[model samples]
Target chain A: MADKIFRVNMADLTTSIEDIPADWAGHGGRGLTSTIVSAEVEPTCHPLGQNNKLVFAPGLLSGTAAANSGRLSIGAKSPLTGTIKESNSGGTAAQLFAKAGCKALIVEGLPKADNWYSLALTPDGVTITEEKELIGQGNFAVVQALENRIEGKHGLLSIGQAGEMRLASANISIKDPDGSLRSCGRGGLGAVMGAKKIKFITVDPKDGKVAIAKPDAFKDANRIFAKALVDHPVSQALGQYGTNVLTNIINESGGFPTQNFTKGQFEGHESISGETMHDTIKERGGKVKHGCHQGCVIQCSQIYNDADGKKLTAGFEYESIWAMGADCCVDNLDHIAEADRIMDDIGIDTIETSVAMGVAMEAGVLPFGDGAGICKLLTEDITKGTGIGRIIGNGAGSVGRAFGITRVPVVKNQAIPAYDPRAIKGIGITYATSTQGADHTMGYTIATNILNVGGKVDPLTKEGQVELSRNLQIATAAIDSTGMCLFIAFAALDDEKCLPALVDLLNARFDLSLTGDDVVSLGQHILKTERAFNTAAGFTSADDRLPEFFYNEPLPPHNVVFDFSGEEIDTFWDF
Target chain B: MKISVKLFAYFRDNRFKIKEYDIDEGTTVGNIVDDLNIDREEVGVLMINSRHTNFDVHPVEKDILAIFPVIGGG
Candidate 1:
């Protein structure tokens, strides 16, 4: 069966499988979600209201035997950033959705009844059922309970207490192969799901398979693609240390965003460094390397354990460590791990919530370096939905507004991640011009600016920053569409065999003659479509800017402020 | 001349995390990497006093030099 658009109306409790629209036939993942939202969703609709539709899509190569193609893109009007949002994650859901012949799943309209529901999708269609037992539970409990409640192997996506409270920092948690959670961890799409009163959505392919137009050609391309990914030195490093390897590298670059973006380096960076984390994990008998999805060649995820060797968290990423560790001045790895586990269970974006905590700390709600205090706040406040918890749960911008702090680090109301853009000017442009707000993954200029992967661009200079960000943002949009892991870009940029093999994978799967230029065109089209939606939604160039502090308070060590004039930043859109 | 050296990731596997080194005044970053038995290609980033530098650059006294393997992640 050709993949179909699955639509569920919460207001009327109706489900329908519609034929794939002609315009959407070639699109997948972020491209499809953005295209669908632009076509169907009203630009001015309240993000958490009935008019905002939530769309889930697997990439074009997803569910195929392609390496690193198991990413699922979830899109909606963000209650957090208030821009058209697409946050993707790794889990079984993408592969399952693709195998089930679901090109995209669209959930729209508000539920009139004041009750929670769940959607169960099979190869046949979707069924809506009333959910009662696990309504207010955290994501961990929900997954455990569903494991017994549902029979057979299935994929789940759920939201927890934060989502139930409709917090702006809430994220949709997707179940990994081991039943642990991986989050679509930005832009508060979970609040959209919660507003529609969905507790979880499960996908069971039931032996269904994604059809390929040229199987032999696809197998050959996938072989070359996987080799390119595996042969890269960066991939080897990521497999060894996970993404946390960047902690020390970024810290050394003096762009680690320490202590609420006030400084660039942390005095206690050694304790929470990836090197320390790796040795600690080895000592505690935790798995040093793990994959979130089945086809992942680069297993950047890991199972971190507490002192007693009990599992504390998995998929402990650099951004989360930076937010909770350096950005908050918490030195202890175990404390950061505990808080990480809590955030995962709560189904909240760790970057948003922890950065919010940093702002709250600056407001004197708690002293800095209080890791236990951070855990206490998450448990007793955020999870319980206390008034102060709501302030933090709404994200860094909300916390800043509540405390009257002028040095808050947010762009378009979304908290900036680990990088301090004042030192690395390329990323600063990306943070400013990104349609999804201050997201590192949207462009990831760090690869070239700091790591020298694609090529060297002077990090401290403003000369080539705008052009670099524009090119990266465009490529990233296209990469996100294929559902390939963003890490593939390291090899794609440097390895001669990488990108062509990727394009070959797409061509072989769909039987289309897409050249490299076609891929670039796809990327540009996706960005323009997303930008057009944000434009229609009342965003001006002024919205595409970093906070004033980035330009005023020069970061330490470098003693440099983000000096890009608005005109320089506006040039990012020239492409 | 006295300088501090900070090594991270696999560079610290058989070596110290941060150590103080006393060297000749004109010692470049390459000289230190050679002394530490670290391959030039293996060095992903070299920072002197928290700023990006290369193997050819001479570090001043009291500089804090950090070395990392060819690692990249977001």
Candidate 2:
């Protein structure tokens, strides 16, 4: 069967399989999701209203033997940012959707009644059934219950209480290969899904295979690509320490946001560093390196354990640690891990929620460094949808509005992640100008600014930072479309063979003669298309900026502020 | 000159995390790395007094030097 689009209408509980549209044929993952959302969703519609549509797309190379090509893209008009948003995650869903011959899954129209539903996808088509048992459950419970309800191995996407409450920080959780959860943890897409009345969706691809136009060539390209990935030093470090490796390095660079962005470095950084996490994991009988999806050569994820030697969180990442640790001034790794587990179960974006905690702490909701208090709020308030919980769950911008806190570090309503933009000027441009809001993944200038993977840009300076952000954002758009993990970028920037081998894999899979320049064009086109959608949605260049605090306050240690003028930031769109 | 040196990630393997070194005047950052038996190629980031620096530069007294292996993640 040729790849087809699966449409599910909650209004009437109808399902249909349609031919892949010609215009969307060349796009996949973020490209396809953004294109579909741009074309189908009304820009001015309330994100949780009937007019908003949610899209799920596998990357062009997904479901194949290509390494690190299992990321799934989920797009919608964001309830948090009110911009066109695409958040991708690592899981089996993308590969399963591709294997089931599904190019994309579009869910639209809210049900008139309050009944929730679940959609099951197969090679034939989608089947929508009224869902009741898992409606109010957290993601872990839902995944656990479905294991007995479903017959065989299946790919799952579900939301938790936060989603059910329609909080802006709600995230759609994807089931990993090991039954742990990976998340489309940005832009409040989970709330959109919850608003559409979907508790969960299951995908089962039985004896299905993705077709490769040139099998031999594809094999050769994948070998080269995977080799380049595993051979890179950054990849090696990630495997050993997981993404938490950045705690010490970023803290050392004096770009680590601490105590709600008031300081550039954390005093207790050593206690929460990746090295400490790694040692703790080893001592607690946990795996230091684990892959979130199949065929991922750069396994940056890990299984974190508590002092009792039991699993606390899987796929423990740096952003989550930094958000709950340095940002909120909590240094206990176990507390952060427990909070991470709760956020995963609650189906909330950790970055958004923890950053919200930071803002709430600034508001005296709880004192800073209160790890247990943060967890208590996550369980008692946010999960139960209390008034205070809603404020924090709605995200950093919402908390700032609710409490009149001025130092809320957000761009376009989305919480800024681990990197402090004040000390790192290139990332500041990315935070200001990103179409989907303040997402580090939209363009990780850290590679150049801090890590020196691509090259040095002197992160503290304004020179060449705008052009650096523009080029990276363009390249990131293309990469996000390919279903490859963004970690491939470290190798892509430094290794000469990496990007070419990736292009070769795409060419071999699609039987096309695409050059590197064509990849660049695809990236540029995706960015422009998404930008046009945001523009139609009433976003102007004025929206492309950081919070005033970033410009006004000088972070300590370095004592540098994000000094880029509005005109300098506006130049990011000159490309 | 008393220079405080901090090592992170794998650079701390079989070595101390932080130590104060009273070194001869005009000693470069590379001398500290070589004295500590850390490979130059394995160093991802090198900084002194919270400023990114190269190995060739000489360190002043009371300078805090931080060394890390190549590490990248979002």
DockQ of each: 0.80, 0.89
lDDT score of residue A194 within candidate 1 = 93
DockQ, candidate 1, comes to 0.80
* Candidate 2, position A222, lDDT: 97
Cα lDDT of model 1 by residue, A1-575, tens digit: 68999999999999999999899999999999999999988988899998999999999999999999999999999999889999999989999999999999999999998999999998799999999999889999999999898899999999999999999999999999999899999999999999999999999999999999999999999999999999898999998998998888788888989989999989988788788888899999998999999999999999999999999999999999999999899999999999999999999999999999999999999999999999999999999999999999999999999999998999999999999999999999999999999999999999988898898887888889899999999999999999999999999999999999999999999999999999999999999999999999999999999999898898987899999989888988886
Q: Report how large a share of the reference interface contacts model 2 reproduces.
A: 0.89
Best by DockQ: 2
Segments in model 1 whose C-alpha atoms lie over 4 Å from true places: none
Report, for every candidate in turn, its global Cα lDDT versus the true structure.
Answer: 0.93, 0.94
Candidate 2: residue A530 Cα off by (Å): 0.7
Q: Give TM per candidate.
A: 0.99, 0.99
